[model samples]
Target: MMTSKNLLELFTQTRSDSEKICQPLQTEDYVVQPIVDVSPPKWHLGHTTWFFEEFLLAPNFPGYQRFHEQYAYVFNSYYESIGKRVVRTDRGNLSRPSVQEVYEYRKHVTKLMQELISKHWNKDWNPVLEIGIHHEKQHQELLLTDIKYILGNNPLQPIYGAVSNEVLIENSEREFIEIKDGIYHIGHNSESFCYDNELPRHRVFLEPYAISSTLVTNGEWLEFMDDGGYSNTLLWHTEGWDWVKKNDIISPMYWFKNENGIWSQYLLSGSQAIDPKAAVTHISYYEAFAYAQWKGLRLPTEFEWEVAQSKINHGNRWEWTESAYLPYPNYQKPDGALGEYNGKFMVNQKVLRGSSIATPANHARLTYRNFFHAPLRWQFTSLRLAKSL
Candidate 1:
């Protein structure tokens, strides 16, 4: 079992690291829209703070101080039952909160959180706090990915962190590997804390299938573009094309070539040569589906997504699948606010299995689910090619 003091230190340390991620951003770099999928850097910071405020402070801290009353309305995110939050699309307009104020807001929340943990003289101080800490870690990853997308969009191509995208190239071209499927216990085993959506430990049946040995690479995606994957109507679904047209997408996001036609991608390390071997960065489910269709293969379903990942490394990109995000059978929400954690997110989203580069490694599992609106390719996302056997 996770000890209380250790959990407290871990929570504080993780929360502090969230601030570390923001230390590299200049105020203007905080808010830029290359695409709708990214949030402002400031918004990401405050929202994570607000998460701690709402879930942990509101419920746990009896004397919790309101950092700024507007943040409740400003940062309440997707929790309809919680009341009206700042409108989803308008979070970028919160110039009043100023970057410094948001940092102070974070400080106020952290001071109280640490004080609360010091008072945890009872058994109630167990998994709920652990859950809150990991939950914040998810936001930490999102902050990094969202900022990368936001920076990638700027015509100026702003840099967010000193980190370079030049991590040693894993082999760029991936080979296909077959997976013989069978019954598997899929979901959190309750050995450590997990999100509610990964619960009720269900049995799933998977047919024999094959998954790509590596994520689809930039070289292959460029082939799709060269093959007219985007312009071809027959390759895209109705909604996918509508999304393509709405965004005026000719190529995958964040891809640009200089007059020299050398493919360079905006990466965490700033713009770098597009690695033919690197996993293609910004293709949507629609785009991924079109590419898969073009290849005469299908995207894996969630069950198959889980089955295939049950075969490999722990965290990488949240592997995209053909499955829509939905409630599982017997998927009852846990009592109280924890119910709102994932249950409310089932609508209008797609299920992504596995973890992404931004996700914390220790916290991910085969059962862990990631979801995003269909057109969202900004998250550290990629697809695993699958075929029916």
Candidate 2:
């Protein structure tokens, strides 16, 4: 249990971090959603604030006035039990509730949250408050990705900002970290913070497998493309092949050939020559799988990935796995609206392990399971190779 003072400090820092990430955006930059996969920056701001208001404030704080009563209809994402909400696809289309109003909404919720935490501590509400902070951090990542898409796709290809001071130096070389075949315990066994999906720690058997020590890089992907990886349908799943043909995809998102026949990738810091050393990102599950197949290797199963996690380098990109996003044995959703968070999204998605550069500090864990539909790759998704020995 967190003390009142500790919780208040955490709340303040997490809330400030969200705003810090949004500081680079211009007013107009907050409202445009270039693609359905990306929500407008303003919606993320409002929705995260609404999370605390709906879940914590209304239930706990007496006489808590809603900043905007109708905001719930626009911000409640995929919570079927939480009354009606704006459809996911239509979020970008909204221009009302102006950006300023959303900031005001955030301020209102933050003030109430401060009041709640400043009072004597309630052990019961502490966990919910922690979850809300982490939830906002998750949106912080989405905000960066959505902003990348919005800016990267424009004809002008504007840079959102300069690269952070801490540069990501590439791994010196890739190696295969060997994991011996055995029964292994997986999932969250720690008493610390973890999502429900990572709970109910379970056991699984695995064959001896070797996972790459580092992520596949842009230069490596260039080899696959040079060898006609995309045009070769046999290297891809049937549905993936259909998706490729449908979308006319040839390379990773944000990559293009230059006038000198060189390739470069567009990023928040603007277009730069594809770095051979840095991890390749913005790839779909299909693309990751296809790349593995092209190399006569495979993506690791989630269990295998977990077992080999500490043995390899990670936290640079979300790595696609061969595992489907599913419930563990004896999994149970928490009661009420919190239950709706991860349980409902279990079907028809692939699991990606590890955090990305865009992930917030202390937001991801080794057991964290990030999921997305196989065809969507707008996030900072990447891959590695594994093989049964």
Best by lDDT: 2
Candidate 1 lDDT by residue in tens digits, 168-269: 244444656687778876677767777778777788778898877667778888898888888999998899999988879877667788768887777777
Deviation from native of the Cα of residue 47 in model 2, angstroms: 0.3
Query: Could you estimate the TM-score for every candidate?
Result: 0.91, 0.97
Considering only N, C-alpha and C atoms within 3 Å, which residue pairs clash in candidate 2?
Answer: none
Q: How many clashing pairs in candidate 2?
A: 0
lDDT of each: 0.76, 0.88
Compared with the true structure, what per-residue lDDT tens digits does model 2 show for residues 195-314? Answer: 999989999999999999888878889999999999999999999999999999999998998878788888788787887766788999999999999999999999999998888888
Off by over 4 Å in 2: 164-169
Clashes of each: 4, 0
TM-score of 2: 0.97
Best by TM-score: 2
